[model samples]
Target: MLQSLTGVEKHNIEKKQAKALFESTLWSDAQTIGVTISRGFEWDTKHIIESGWEQGKQMVVPKCNPEEKSMQFYRLNDFQQLETVYFGLQEPKPSATEAVSPDQIDLLLVPGLLFNTNGYRLGFGGGYYDRFLANFKGNTIMVASQQQKCESIPVEAFDRPVQYVLTEEGMKQSK
Candidate 1:
């Protein structure tokens, strides 16, 4: 549904959601933020990136290591430094900067196709975020549309739940 969004729909929804995120206490208090590069029909993260830059907050973007099936985050200085990687998703270039340990992140914005009330998400099947969140101690959140929130979803034991889910309407704390 996200990929099929019209220009107006994308603009209006993302604007509202990003505004809520930027105004949230989590976003304000966080010094180092971990987020993904928006690809295809995913939620537009440009607003968040630009806002972070203006706030002088450190923004980190993930670089997936397909061989190890893991992800590492590096500081994002400019969008021009990103290169398309696996699955046509943009990732931080290897020479961007040194990796920031997961524990150093203040807040993490996870990406997903859908997020349930329980905080379980249907991701792109890469398990990158799931693996990273396993040992991450920072606050985790996902920005989703109302239609993406379901009553329940199939979750495995290894699946990790985020602390919050922000939508166009408002934020929902995980149960």
Candidate 2:
């Protein structure tokens, strides 16, 4: 019973933590770093979009070929250019154009239902970002509410770990 109550308390704490971190550091830091959109994460990309534009940092979103199970990224010059798609998450349309390579990104903002301090994450399990992240060497961060924290997450060989966990409260180091 005590454990159950503690879990509930932790859940609430994480939610507030996620919000506070954005208001404090992550948003401002994006001015210089490029962030990759994770379609349907719990974050309000509208703020991220506006902040990215205001800061003049290139904002990129993931584009995946479902059957291919692989992912690539594209830069959106403005938030107005983004539109709602398959998952109800806003994304920039590929207009007969290409995007910058993985190595070019300064940071990656990932979405997940759960994340651990160990850098483990459980995404939609599509393996899109998981596969792409394997080749990425830049700042990889996950923005999850506190409730999403787990003691440990199950990881497979192909699943990669993030470098940072930015919750609403503050920044938690992963690596």
The number of clashing residue pairs in each candidate reads: 0, 10
TM-score per prediction, in order, is 0.96, 0.76
lDDT of 1: 0.89
Residue 80, candidate 1: Cα error in Å is: 2.1
lDDT (C-alpha) at residue 162 in model 2? 88
Pick by lDDT: which candidate is best? 1
Q: In order, what lDDT does every prediction score?
A: 0.89, 0.68
Q: Any idea how many clashes model 2 has?
A: 10
Give the clashing pairs for model 2. 14-146, 17-167, 17-168, 17-169, 18-167, 18-168, 18-169, 19-168, 20-168, 21-168
Give the per-residue lDDT of model 1 (tens digit) for 73-175. 9998888889987678898888856688888899999999888888889898989899999999999999899989877788999999999999999777888
Flag regions of model 1 displaced more than 4 Å.
Answer: none
> What is the Cα-based lDDT of residue 166 in candidate 2?
77
